[model samples]
Target: MGAPRILVVDDNKDMAQGVAMVLREAPAEVESAYTADEACARLGERAFDLVVTDVRMPGQDGMQLLDVIVERWPRSKVVMLTAYGTVQSAVEAMKRGACDYVTKPFNNEELLLVVKRALRERQLEEDLQRLQAEFEGRYVFEGLVGRDAQMLGVFDAVRKVAPSHATVLVCGEHGTGKELVARAIHRLSGRKGPFVAFSAAALPDTLIDAELFGARKGAFTGADHDRKGHFVEANDGTLFIDEVGSMPPLVQVKLLRVLQEREVLPVGSSTPTKTDARVVAATNTDLLRATREGRFRDDLYYRLSVVRVALPPLRDRIEDVPLLAEHFLSRRCSERGIAKKRLSHRATRVLLLHEWPGNVRELMNVIDRAVLFCQDDVVEPKHISFDEEATAADLSEPQSYEATKREVLERFQRLFVERLLHECDGNITEAARRAGLTRAAVHRMLKRLGIAAPHPEARRG
Candidate 1:
């Protein structure tokens, strides 16, 4: 909330003070430590937002200090300082949990830039943690995690509407967690009956009526025994009807009658049976458009959407990707009975850059696969593999010529730059040289492509 506290640790008193002085130019409280032990002592007294430490100290080196800080004060971010020859050690320090690194002969501007970036990152991390705590305490809705304004509004809506008997309509793209929202509403509704879910799209038109409104024995070809429909099965509770837009016209009429009369007319029976199910319907299609087009009944649409909850796609809330990734990683690791693993900073950047057309479900699957394949305690960029086919399929959808051209060019540029970097072993300067461009040009290109460059030391041509 106030000026960030920073600790500069170096065995050389002059180097430590000089680093501290440079950092003091920013709006930060800076202190100097001549040894790792003294740095630990300062940390014990109070937490510092960021620690800038030399890689090769006298007694306990920066790497050891990094381990201590990571284990004890997990919130504090560390930046390693190394000479040009010792850049590898700095890279290793990053793998061990340091936020960033700087070479010893770095310029004042460079040091200040790195320190400022580290401080900003620390602040963002703190903000995310605070939000997570707040959501967990107030909402306490399991399996839902987000800091986006739209998602927060959805949480608020669910909390306010859960105690009511009104039907809820949840609309979102496929894999956007529409069902999760439905389940959350059901959980908080304080109903005594079990939650029952049925998907209209999962069944054929012939069986939809039987599934939703019970079928008597000998009523249909496969009706060997009398069956209770979803309405009766979910009596006094919530019935989640997924892909509600896929319901047939006749079924829609029947569903409306059941909603209006609180009863279902089973097939092959003249008498209607009373039911008391609370309906929570979900759809990925535009039901309003369907109503206008005469494909979906307008009356049914109005009846189902007494309380509407719209979920934003993952791309709309890219800022929450890191938090969601971490959540999936932790859960996946626990399920596999393995030690907890974390995503590397570069890997996190890669995820943030992704256009998750598949939304939250896709992200969960990606994290699950990454955790299963990652060999070490950290998941790096190499371990993350996006669904290229899915992305390609998305690009193939109908669009304007200019939109298609722009998307193709962007994809080509990203692929070309990535291959160039790979050929040069992640050296941006060499990659730039091969592409007949300046290093700064290549840097800008990488930024535009949402590609995270290699370590700073790796970029020095």
Candidate 2:
């Protein structure tokens, strides 16, 4: 909420002040510490977003400060400053958890750029931590999974408004877990009645009103007996209307009346019955745009959206893919009474790179299929497939067997190296170590595959 707080540590007073002055021009609050002990004292007093410390300071040097900062304030980003001859030391600092390093005698603009980058990274890490906390049961909401900042924001909104009686409009792309959110809201709403769900798209336009509001006996062709509707069934609780944007315009007017008057008027009945059902409606389409096009009632949209919750598409929160996949695997395995299957590293890499146009639903189906087809304990890339049309198109290709084989191998090699580099933070030495290969061999592979390390700052021996 405030300017990122930064601590500048250098033994030279003038140097620290000059660096602080340069950083002050940026969006930061800079504090000076002449020694590692002083910096430690300052850190103990308050948490900083980023710390800039010289590599060679009096007594405990920057490396020591780096280690202490890494241990004490793991979320804070540290940038090491060093002379040309000690670049290796700066790289060592990076291994010790420093984000990036800077050579001494740098200009204001260069320093500001690195500082800004570090702060941005700090914010991302913080968001990730918050997300992890939410995933680990800090929030009482259930059936929803994600630690992305956007998802956490949704959780915060749900927590704030679930206790109230305000109507909620859950908007997102299809299969983004809008219904899960609605169920969570109801579960946490402290309501006594059941959580009733109705799919507006599945219901016929002729019967939607009768489904939402009770119909008296002999009211319609199929109405042989009096029937209670979702509003009454969900009385004193939540009524989740899925794909609500598909409701016919005529039904929209009746829904708006229920919201306005807190009463449901049955079809073919003159009397209106009072009801207390909290409405939580979801739609994948742009209801506001639908209103502009006269397909939906604008007044009803406003009424249902008194408290809106928008779910983030899977693509926007790729970091949560592993967790979601694992969750699905365990749940499905338990359901089928089969042993749990794990995702191979290569399979997970492919999942991470995929463009999930169908959002979470597509991912779930992919995992489900992979589990069923995978004979081994681990699900591999060959076992995972999506888009039947794409599969058919590929099958119809007339390429020679050799050409197809070469292409597939090359693609697999590229993906493998890229994922390793990413996991190792683009440090070729670390990647090589993890892959059990020589650094020179890894470089050769990268060159052959036409791949370059993405993080230049992370390059190390």
Candidate 3:
């Protein structure tokens, strides 16, 4: 296509020419219209990428023309330039589908920036519409879930950053949903590139360089063909490096160079290739600590630490457990065409009370397990399982009034014999003296209570 065509509309010839000149300096060609009437005529002559119109033109003002543009060319971006700043007029212009409003005395750069951004958004929306039609809902951008205050804050941040070319660094503990956050960023970002992911731990130490930076054919053994690694393949999209903290030293150096230089020097290659993909890295380990300990490079940590977003662990945000649980349950149940299930009130209480060491991933696993084993539409407290012994025991075998009394009386007799034995090492006379009983009485109590000499290594947990 030729240079993007922009229509500049105003009643004053000088003002219209000034607006046209401003747009002409951009990566676009400008056509001037003295009035809204002329703008309508120009629209019929040829299509334009954007329309910069003064809001208060005579006869038919910018608002009336904007409605016409919306009715006829809904894809076109229209920005209203008003000399008089009226809240009512601006609001009405916005309601009528004006992309942006700029008052008189606006700087040229400000106007240009607004116009360029509006055009970019229009193009992005058009591309997204086309992609949605082409894909036919074959993909899933719906798995991410959160409703807590912090999560809402994260959502707002993601939305704002996704459309930009900024590099995002996700920091959190293991299984705190970093990948999900990355995916959300990808879906919200308007780039049409592929999403690629790689685990640092899964690659052999010797192959980290080639796996990330690609390798020429015959560069080494098992190299049958030239290759494109995650960086090249994810151009114009996202490159998600998970467990980035575990990246080997050599690879860390190279990755840092790529991030800083925006170019990749593949293994065995003389020339470096330019890459345009946005990098989003996630790590579970304390990178700062690793840097201090020399396990991770300090320079690399700071380079990748731009725009850091720390995710809260499930244990820290227990209030969201039920929301996440229900989200997972509905998703899993839908996948299998089963009736959706909800955790009972009591079961939800149990879930909230337990510590979630594994974070959102752990919550998903529990919900999956519950959905698999549960037959009814509601999951009960007994149906839930906690891998931790203390939490599990509390739910599985709660203390009853009678059971507590019986255990207390039995524990008194058992401890009396055990204490004596510990003091005497099972000598009958010494044990009886400590227990305040005869040798036969001490032996009988020990036999009745089934108490034995305690083993030091028996209770490791």
Best by TM-score: 1
lDDT of model 3 at position 338: 88
Give the per-residue lDDT of model 3 (tens digit) for 1-461: 46778999999899889888888877788989988888998898889889999888889988899999999877778999988978998898888898899999899999989988987887788788888555433222335566666666666777787887777878888888788888888888988998998888877765778878888988888888888877999989899999998888889989989988988988889999888878889988888899999999998888877668888787655557776787688789999998888877667766766668888887888888889889998998767776664452244545443453344446545655666666666566777776578878876777788865344354222
TM-score result, candidate 3: 0.55
Clash totals for all candidate models? 0, 0, 0
Q: Which runs in model 2 stand beyond 4 Å of their true positions?
A: 1-135, 138-141, 389-461
Candidate 3 or 1, higher lDDT: 1
Give the per-residue lDDT digits (tens) of candidate 2, residues 1-461.
78989999999999999999999888689999999999999999998999999988779999899999999888789998877537577668778999998997888888889999888888887888788666668532477877777888999999898999999999999889998899989988999999999999877776999999989988889999888899999999999999999998889989999999999999889999989999999999999999999999899999999999999888767667777888888788889899889986667666765668899999999999988998888987788898752431233334543454455557657877988987887888988999889999999999899897455754543
* Better candidate number, 1 or 3, judged by TM-score: 1
Q: Can you give the lDDT of residue 325 in candidate 2?
A: 87
Indicate the TM-score of model 1.
Answer: 0.58
Please estimate how well model 1 matches the true structure, expressed as its whole-model Cα lDDT.
0.86
| TM-score of each model, in listed order | 0.58, 0.56, 0.55
